[model samples]
Target chain A: MATEAKRTRKNAQSGIFAVFREQEAAIRRFVRRISPSSSDVDDIAQETILRALQAEREREISQPKAYLYMIARNVVRDAMDKKSRSVIDFIEDFAPESVSSHEPLIEDQVDGRQRMLLFWEAVATLPEQCQQVFVLKKVYGYSHAEISRKLGVSVSTTEKHVAAGLRRCSDFLDRRAAESGLNETRRRSAGKGE
Target chain B: MTRPEALSADAPDLTSEAAAWLAQLETGRLSSRDLAAFREWIQRSPRHYAEIHRLAELSREVNILAGMAEPLKAAAQRRRAVQRLWSIPVLGWGSLGLVATCALAFTLLAGMPDPAPAVPEPVFLVTPVGETREVALEDGSTVKLNTDSRMEVAFIKGRRNIYLEKGEAFFNVAHDAGRPFTVYAGDRSVTAVGTAFSVRWTDRELVVTVSEGKVAYGEAPARAAPSQASDAGKVMPASSAPVSSPRTMLGPGHRLEVSPLNRAELVERLPENVLSRELAWRSGFLDFQDAPLSEVVSEMQRYTAQEIVIADAELADLRFGGVFRIGQTDAFFEALELSFGVNVEQTDDNKLILKSVN
Candidate 1:
């Protein structure tokens, strides 16, 4: 009986590792998406998979894919906390001139305006009802139930409207970005000719 | 180059799918099964990760602009006008209210300079057939114009006035105790300090529907004396009217129909559902209950270029009832043919003739 138990434990360990091997790339990608500035993406992803495996040993993970992503997100958060602490320490060692001011930088100001323009342009492409639904929910911060009641629509309809709005806005922004990039290249080539 | 071209062809669909997922996640009510499905979806391709990452970044940037939610809402409401101005793809922000809001938010956040004050001007707004438009005025009021509508807005000194030249319009007047909001339609005018109502004018009659606070509806005071002929056809100043006329006060759900020729006025109190049905065109729908086929055809004709004529007089009074989209003439025709045994024929002049099947 003791030998049988040992064999079962060994098989479970191998099973978890095999699953981890299959999901390693996805874990890394999720980590990178969550914390794009992090340089330790691979390390954090590996740590997340190992921790997930440890949890699997304690209990059955019914949805292994979701479990892996949830763990990856937590691992990224911890990594960010550690990095922010180091950053704070570095700032503490600097002089007054080295510290950034409370006021936003000029580039940040430009970026804010750009973002506003992009948002408005993207929203303009939606239908009137969808636009109203999106603005009420995202800008006015109304709950889905409140929006449905106010707009005299069903909650399910409101959800569909919101999803449609997001998809259209995303597509609009992507197209605009691509078009502008193409224009920039064209202008550069023309300037070279001049 | 071929590889990149192939990827770009399918990129938009993938991006939209990712955006849908992000929206679901935002609802904060996703089940465990949904999360598992999302995981499976994301692992399908490396492109999925890229699309989600791009959308996530875009969503975050949008949240940052939520600090100026009022302006964003206004922009969304006036999307048609913005789209027209922005069609050039050059970044020229046309809405003064939006610019002011952005400047105010920027000033509060980054100590930026304030934008110049906007000068009040007479703005003429028109909507084509089968279309509706919503405009947000500087005083926080919103006007939703129905299909094929025309209106002129002028705000000066102590008063706000809207001239409904043609078609119908609904106004949600912001509470401004100092200024009374008035809409002038044909021979009638409706005035309110703060209320929500709609005014519709045709050649033969005028209709006013009050959905919110009380409003006074009566004959418009005569235009200012000819001495101010320079302002003829222009928005008259506030001091033009000294005559006091009898005005009828209307409460919520009250609809007043006035015939200019006969000088007859009728007021009826409508139920909530009926009122919503009357105003359904604001949301691009028309609701009818046991109405005559002629009335439905005329109403539907207003939203389409095609003229609908009843070939048989017997079918004119046929009772038809249903809710339909305003501009979907094909679907309406299909329903009529399938359910009502009506045969629809199209003529070369873009007219539709309805005839009985038997």
Candidate 2:
């Protein structure tokens, strides 16, 4: 019985460590994405993880990965809210990778920089709503709570907006891929047809 | 929200569509529904996520380029302007606000200022309308007061003193040990040994709040504003021995207030981040927390001619919490309308009024 209790504690501790190692890079990316001050990236990353732990303690863990990411996202926002950098401007210059390098690898790796820029132009031109949501969520550093307060919307609304914006933005990228010569649609359809 | 494009046996022009959407996102504008729809579409495909990641990466680089070039471009413009002025001195004089503007431009390009350059004067500065004054202080605390605000520096032995006679101010108080610094208004004196804080005072009352560290606070002598023969002012006479009252300690979260009738006292336990809103004026951003619409508009009016008038008494009292970019009154009202579902109308008299809709 003592060993079992000890084991559970150990698992919880390991789980916490695994979560940090896994999400540290992504959270750093998120902070860099949103933080105006590059120097604050590490501090914000630390804060995001700490806040995620605090949040996890209060709630039941259904999906730890999603939950932890959500906490990290919120931490970014809370810091922003406290600092009041909620409003995302159009001219903000921050590479998404500077936001975080936890992005999906392109199977067809070309000049990494050019490919990324091509994609950024497409995303940058996303409708204003999509851009703001993506920026607020991805850059300019806001949690759903902070974003909602700044935009005068609800947390759910911010989430929905971000999700939808991501979906469309992803679709836009697929078209960009096709335009750039990769027949993503054909590839997807072939995978589906198989 | 726009529905996602269904996958046809033959692929459509996904690249153009994707580019358009990405462009929209980069521009930082899209309808709420559109944003939601886009996210949904992204979830529909692994390809979508890859593309977004790719695009996000690109945007990041673009931003870096822009940020890097920003200084060069600004410097180029400045050089050109200076060159142009060399040819034509008369054109230079037309740029009246150019000096401050150029200083700011340089600061942004070079990143933050050097500690000494950024270290402002300890003596507080006050500027009248259409006039600007910069002060070099002893301890190197730089204070910039907007037009019409009054500020004074007085050192009484161990205490560094500042009195906000009127209007609003931004205080970047240099950190120091040994001597405690305090800004006095009405009945409350906002005291700080280190870190930055802002104090705003009006004719009716005074407010002192802290941004960083803890502020050693005592009420300024809340005495009646010398009354005229005209309006009967509501005020309580303060005893000269009010200093005999016990000193009240104010931490960051505490908002200290004292009207003439009331000695400077801890009025509320506000959030420690209250300095976020108090010091916003420095950034040209005005943020409020359950702040009155009338007060918000009045503050806005201070910076611009466009006045916001509250139509309903209750609406006037309606609290708003959000950061408004300095001079972005239109965006401010739009957010208000979106949140409240109210109609904002511009009156003939040029006042923006918020009216309740059934």
Candidate 3:
């Protein structure tokens, strides 16, 4: 009976791995989209697969792809929480070299400043109410409920404004980046530069 | 690639769809069905992935720029002011074209004071009993004032000072090396450059709890030595005062209590659960773990106007453990009566009296 159980366990492990392998590239892309640091993408993806395998052993995962992505989101959240704590530690410990190394070069600073100017211009192009809602929700980190209460609008209205603002601003940035040929250079240098 | 051609054809719609998905995710209230649908949508096409990835990058960039919240806010206000100006039916201004209008706007803007980083009057923020408020400061810091709290905010050129007159408040201080944030409570003060901490001040004692970063808790140099005001100024400048009293450096999960009457200081490193429970009031809930009934009653009393009197000492000593919503006095009393063999009486004066059943 023990041997039979072991055989079934091995078969389940292979089955889960097979599914994970097929979706690994897409999973990595999803992780890269959500994670703040590039270095953490592989580790988070691996952790997600392991968690999925463990969960599959306990029960059948009806939608394996969605299950994997859900696990990936949770793993990313946990990693972010831990990373924030370590960031606090880094600030407290005060490593001069580590701090200096993170500072952008002069050219990068100029590039960042230009992009910020373009971003503000994009925000300026938004409608009046959309601009207000977007600023409150995105910049000040106000909740949708708070924005609705303060502005005397419904929460759903605020959500719509935020969505519209994001859509317009992203399109504006993309158009400008393409115009200046910055996107081409960025793609060549970093493959997926922000 | 063919992906680019396909994306160009449906770029606008795809971008809008991605943005809507992102906004939903930002709410942090997505149902399981929503997640499943989102997964299926993203996997439908590589173009979907590319669109979302681009928008997510833009979102992150915007978040980073949120550190300049004050300037961005000022800019938005300026635009609103211009629009308001444009709507006015000023004579002869209607003939001005867009360029002329912009020039006039610039001249008008030059006449006004610089709105960005302008020093404003002090603002007083208060929250009544059974209510809490969150205020975002001009400097990007946020303060959550608990029930019955009174706080005065004064932000100057180089300092951000908050006077907590009564009750408790939590501070999420923005990082500004040039401007240090300080909270003055009674004779003691807590200073932080960039950190998150909460301070509670009553008549007799002060409690400081640090949840993130670090804070320095010490006696206010100016207030502590009022007798030697001139000497204190000479010996310790406002910026470079070497505190005579011991300054406690508190990190995450550290709780410090100082009592003026006894001149006692207690520093305890609370576990994660205890720390979270202590700070749970921020979330509109009070958590108790095997605390005495009297302690629980007193804590609950902070949130309500009604008085709770324990008539029997034994009844007050009964250990109770439960999580309760703040200001739910009726439910709390009912629970006590149901489980602790206690009876609650309402007096003629609208006071609640707890009595032993046996």
Q: What DockQ class does candidate 1 belong to?
A: incorrect
Arranged by lDDT with the best first, the candidates are 3, 1, 2
- Could you give candidate 1's per-residue lDDT for residues B1-358 as a string of tens digits? 1114466576747756776776665555679898778777766765565455445444544543333223333444356655554433223212224432322211211221244122244567677787765666777777777778877676654567777778898888888978788887755678888998999876547899998999988777654532233336543323335323537999999999987689699999997667877887665456665678899898887788888999978678776655454455565776566445478999999889999754
User: What is the lDDT, from 0 to 100, of the residue B129 in candidate 3?
Assistant: 89
RMSD versus native structure for model 1: 22.8
Error of 2 at A97 (Å): 19
Best by TM-score: 1
Off by over 4 Å in 1: A1-194, B1-120, B224-239, B242-246
The C-alpha stretches of model 2 lying farther than 4 A from their native spots are: A1-194, B1-138, B144-148, B154-159, B220-246, B259-264, B267-269, B272-275, B288-295, B298-307, B317-322, B334-351
Candidate 2, B1-358: lDDT as tens digits: 0123553323354433444455455434579998777767656554444444444433333332121111111222333332433342221222333333322312212222244322223233455442223333345554555545766555434445665667666565667777666666644566666765567776656666655567666535553432223323422222222232337666655666766464434457764245444654553345565576678767666655656667766566555555444444555676566443346898898877777532
Backbone clash count for every predicted candidate, in the order shown:
0, 67, 0
Q: What's the DockQ for every one of the candidates?
A: 0.09, 0.02, 0.12
Tell me the lDDT of model 3 at B243: 35
